[model samples]
Target: MNTLSILPFFRRLAGTCRLASALLAGALTLPAAADALPLEKIALPPGFTIELLARVPNARQMALSPQGVLYVGSMRAGKVHALPLDRDYRPGKLRVVADDLKLPVGVAWRDGSLYVSAVDRILRLDGIDARLDDPPAPAVVRDDLPKETHHGWKFIAFGPDGWLYVPVGAPCNICEPDPERYATILRMRPDGSQLQTFARGVRNTVGFDWHPASGALWFTDNGRDWLGDDRPPDELNHAPKPGLHFGYPYCHGDAIADPEFGRKRACDEFTPPAQNLGPHVAALGMRFYTGSQFPAQYRNQVFIAEHGSWNRGRKIGYRVSVVTLAGDRAVSYAPFASGWLQDESAWGRPADVLVLPDGSLLVSDDQAGAIYRIRYAGERKASGIPQ
Candidate 1:
């Protein structure tokens, strides 16, 4: 469909449903536009400011093209959007790139094509950035992925090795399924050839990135639930090379044995997490800071979006977190931006984060159906840190 046709459809959808705001309690006001929300409610560290980049319904993952067009995907909304940005990297016109897709939660840009993952299939829109106003029909890249809806949505990215990496989660909360099909990260050439499993024994990984200097893979794995609030913490795992298996059905954080499957295998047989995050933090989309916008200390640090916990009695996450690394080891993990969850109520949930070329960061909140831009505006002292 053309931009004109899809623009009206979104306006109608936005006017009647208010998809994101409806999830909140009755007390919260329904912001017609993202700007209507009280921005001060979101708390950030000193010298940083956040603003609404765009109001994208069910915005789950984002990809930016070389020509400055941002493509966003949706999970439940079954749609993909493209927003052309101006010279300031601010969004200009919004257009629907594709719709009627199934759980299209991941998007990636490479070599003038925009790749979208819809559960079982990967579709590509060719020359998408140059034709946002009138996008062409999507061509299939791959369609043989597992179709299980349980934890089936994927996050895809091109690694430093020039291969496309995709993860497949276990179909159940915790079970040993077909090793070749589930609980693994797979990589393939751009044309969807030479598919091979990269990492195994992963429960569910929604985000991953290669280290800036080392080029090793790091990912966030959501821990299996129903183990109480503090039992199995989510994980930040490192896979320096292929054939690494992260403990999943058998073991959890720091070699904690699983109640059912732990007896089958020893915890020490598999790789352990580099850093154990909060229990059920649902950490997603992470990126290594390669821009000079922040302090020098943050140059190679990793920033994560914690989607927050739902089953835990006391909620955690719903914030942007940072993991400081010291030569491949995580030295510290802390909150960078929070305030989404207050007094057991949350109005937004962060799903993904992206670092722009200009050093600003973009965060996508699926619950709020909006994208937020975070920029470092503080002055740095002689110590090379923010004052």
Candidate 2:
């Protein structure tokens, strides 16, 4: 080899080594997205600890299969994710089960199939439990829904009656759209047949669950916006039977009449809310605490994921809340987990909640793009310490 060729070769080798060193330094300095999410500042109740379980981008609603796979849906990611849990229920590698869907924020698992709700349609993936790695193409369950995107995202679940329940939000904030179509909760067979409106006047309900004792349907309905910061309130409603209207555009909260539509109908004409939640809290997903891990008082209660208020003068509800129930009535409402909002800035927002088989609870946060596991570790370790 000539001297000139050897000198050029050495120069090239030095350049390659420098590039490798810079890349390694960058990799070490910039941590994974999940590792950057701070969890120590979060506050929970005594004997309960919260852990960052998995990092799922735009994580919204969640469904757990009987075989321990956690299927997650997203709002803007346009994909559904599956995370297989290990023996200790730790999430394994993440997999994209479906992609290129529009605002598919709801997921429900039934009979080995995964049901997902996009804005104007519902799709089902058959044998999803067995094919998380190579998911099958989805079959359209229903597509005739209204196409409006305003408040259009839905939260779906199969009821105790063995029917799939879906919500269609009102197109506008406070419009009197077609009574038969908008602002209603509709139920149908798993194949999307026999579809009928189960409840009406629901402005937007992103979450609901049946009572463990009575099997009554209860849901969290987000009240209309621009109702001032404290006038109208979000609702936790109960509908044991069908054909009930909880008052929309006409009446809000218990009896706060709407300015434009109040004169059209009397407030007494419609059923009031079962519980008036915080005004403009943006409560989304809720579930009955069917777990035995928490204290005795926590059994069969309701856990609500308040996604946090957007337009209010002050921020509210970037945390998980608890609603205590006596029989069918909500007796008390309190914060179960909080501290996501430090003053005006929010680091995380709770989206959906699911109860585990071992009685722990899983809360999904779309703001921080993570899922958190809340477990009870007895009173000795109750001081917000990780158990």
Candidate 3:
């Protein structure tokens, strides 16, 4: 064959090789998007539909405003995003509200002010509702928080008592810390006055909600990792009153004695969890369903986002679970929404769950950088529009 003919054949072979390489790269990237990690896969009951609402990178915790705006905080990005929702709970526009902070992981809105938790500071923006399109300068409400990066980011909320509750997590996986450091929950005035320890011996609790009927506090605690796959399950605790202790370091999930912190004390000395969630589940945001859109059974049920596990050999806890509260204790548990983690080899980590004013559920997935909306279609809506 002539030289020109050979040149064309070689060119075709090179193009074919490039195409094959591109396909391989895409194949490797697809699983991370397709498979659900513990927090990303939520299993809802029948008749409820869950759809991806927004995709946010490294979302850690979320807060919803009274006007129905969804604000999300990110750990890796060190930023907060405001996601606007339409009538159907679908995200309409996503805007970066603030950025370049020190690992902002939590966000809250109260009285038109926005409060955000950075690693070593609690910052707030006044008249946040008026500046939704243009975030004003943030003022430091409280500083001098411990500089330890691990578990330093916080979930901040203004409880019914008008006190701001902040959780300081243990810096290390397991260690006795200075009195000012982790394993405790603290409450203070909105102006950072009258700081008091509300609860102690709590390793790390990222999500909490006040009881609708009783005004008590409830939170989720993550168990220590590398303690086998089944021992020391995570916890869902209730603080009927302040100064309560949910055993950490000394005890774990229900009555399981910690191998590291247990010595001469009995697990009964500390208040046990309302229920044991699971081992290494990394439970994050939680909310109580008090809306009327769902059936009567869903009222007062607790919904939690399990962020899943990384240290375990086999994956677990990539979905949201509901805890049925019977008076003071959890009677039973079941999955609410799932399908985020597509397979055992893949992962999509969910971080937070928020309920909107319209009685819809919004779930934030950090790994996949997406938020999902779950809503119940009533009989009238389920059927075609009335003729």
Model 3: lDDT to the true structure: 0.80
- CA lDDT, every model vs. true structure: 0.89, 0.90, 0.80
Q: Quote each prediction's TM-score.
A: 0.89, 0.92, 0.85
> Residue 77: error of model 3 in Å?
0.8
User: On TM-score, who's better, 1 or 2?
Assistant: 2
Candidate 3 residue-wise lDDT at 183: 84
Q: Write the per-residue lDDT of candidate 2 for residues 239-324, one digit (tens) a residue.
A: 99999998997999999889999999998988898888999889999999998889999999999999999999998889899999
Please give the RMSD to the true structure for each candidate, in Å: 8.5, 3.7, 5.7
Badly placed stretches (over 4 Å) of model 3 are 1-43, 87-90, 378-387
Better of 1 and 3 by lDDT: 1
Q: Which ten residues in a row have the lowest lDDT in candidate 3?
A: 378-387
Per-residue lDDT of 8-47 in model 1, one digit per residue for the tens?
Answer: 8889889667655565644454455423545567778778
TM-score (C-alpha) between model 1 and the true structure: 0.89
Give candidate 2 regions above 4 Å deviation. 1-34, 379-387
In order of listing, the candidates' clash counts read 0, 1, 20
Model 3: how far residue 71 lies from native, Å: 1.0
Ranking by TM-score: 2, 1, 3
Clashing pairs in 2: 47-382
| Cα displacement (Å) at residue 80, model 1 | 0.8
